[model samples]
Target: MKNKQLTFFLMAALFLIPMQVKAEQVNLYAAGSLRAALGDVAKAFEAEIGNQVATEFGPSGLLRQRIEQGEAAHVFASANMEHPQNLVGQGQKGPVALFTRNNLCALAQPGQTVTTATLLDVMLDPAVRVGTSTPKADPSGDYAFELFGKADQLKSGSTAILTAKALLLTGGPDSPKAPEGRNLYAWVMDEQKADVFLTYCTNAVLAKKELSGLQIISIAPELSVGADYGLLVLDGASQEAWRLALFILSPEGQKILGDYGFVVGGLPAKP
Candidate 1:
């Protein structure tokens, strides 16, 4: 009888030990471009750490604005360093880390006559409707305008011409929402919003997958702009949030980002 009671008590304590390791929840706000990749990363983290990750995806700039406005979040991943750096300037925390990289690309409608060499002329064509996200509200748009600035270096007055003619089609509060489970760039092209849209290469790849035959044209080096993604943990966040940040910079997480066509380079050695 004594032996049986001791065995039962040990079993009960063993079961209760697992319960004592209470799971934590990490709130994450990230750039819309990271939706697929980060979703996978979050799943992997949850499985490994037994913690819940609540994610919100949107334009990086707008997400930063929300965080600045007192919305509680554990981590923030921005498309460009500027937005996260802005938070650091405001005393968010230290050591804003670069997690991934992306490059500008042109997503052309099906059968559009465009290529790396001819991309400039095709975009310059007065009849071609060029689309861009809202500058300052999204880093993709800022990169698009930066590409335009490079174009000016190649051909005088190109910036004025491109910026003046470009259509702000997405990444704004007033922008039309894409259909459920539809890629915004693909849907915009399907709706005939523009003949050519300037966006991230990763976005172009996803758009092409969604809308078959949509062309993903690489920008020439002269006009190419690369985006640096930044990762930040807010001051006073749970340790689980920092763990999520480290997981994103881990080899597994970077592999997931690379598999999604993002340029994963220059990452710090994993600790």
Candidate 2:
């Protein structure tokens, strides 16, 4: 009887030890645009792996700066390849996988007459306010500027005109802060910060969802720019960090991103 009781106690202790060791903390820094989608993805990942994911979201460029300044992020998901690639150049040991893609769109307030066909004309109108994120601090801004460059090809001097007139509204250090749980683009438009805002299609979609009557107009193919999102796992990161990266590239992860309106082309096959 004594021997049997000792064996049962040992088994109970073993079970409790596995339970205590099962959950590890994963530090994830990701683009602000990915908040909704990644929030769900993190929940799913946690359920599957029994690991806790501590997430932080902000402009991809700003997040990259934080990581470079030694903020101790295990995984970094950027809205553009350039920022993560810059980390690779800094000896972060990366192949910098392209995890998702986004496209530029015009988020116009209600009553604005803008369409793919006449986006350039409306943006160039002197009375119209065109808002964009801060370039070098947000990939959305870079893509918007790229769109402006494309516009120049369609209409002479468009790049100079648009760039000069574009308002650095969001993603800047001094940009107006959105209220808690508010969509930045939606809040900006609601506040009449800009008559027309150039942002990601995903952002525009969420903004429109948050603020009814907002218009999401696709940029004409001739003047459109694609944003390539990159995922990187820094050197010396825990295995959980690498696991999270792979999970993001997995079919399940790709589906979540697709549902959020990101381009999931060239993703891995479902297993």
lDDT of candidate 2 over 1-271, digit per residue (tens): 9999999999998887845456568999999889999888999899998889999998889999999899989999999999999999988889899999988899998999888898899999999999999999988998889888888788899999999999999997677789998999999999999999999999999999999999999888899899999999988888999999988888888899999999996566668
lDDT of model 2 at position 220: 85
Instruction: Summarize candidate 1's per-residue lDDT along 89-185 as a digit string, tens digits.
Output: 9987657999999999999988799899999888889999999999898999999999998898878888899999999999987888999999999
- lDDT of candidates 1 onward, in order: 0.92, 0.91
Model 1 Cα shift for residue 41 (angstroms): 0.7
Candidate 2 residue runs with Cα over 4 Å from true position: 1-22, 266-271
Q: Clash pairs of candidate 1?
A: none
**Runs of candidate 1 exceeding 4 Å displacement:** 1-19, 266-271
Ten contiguous residues with the weakest lDDT in model 2: 15-24
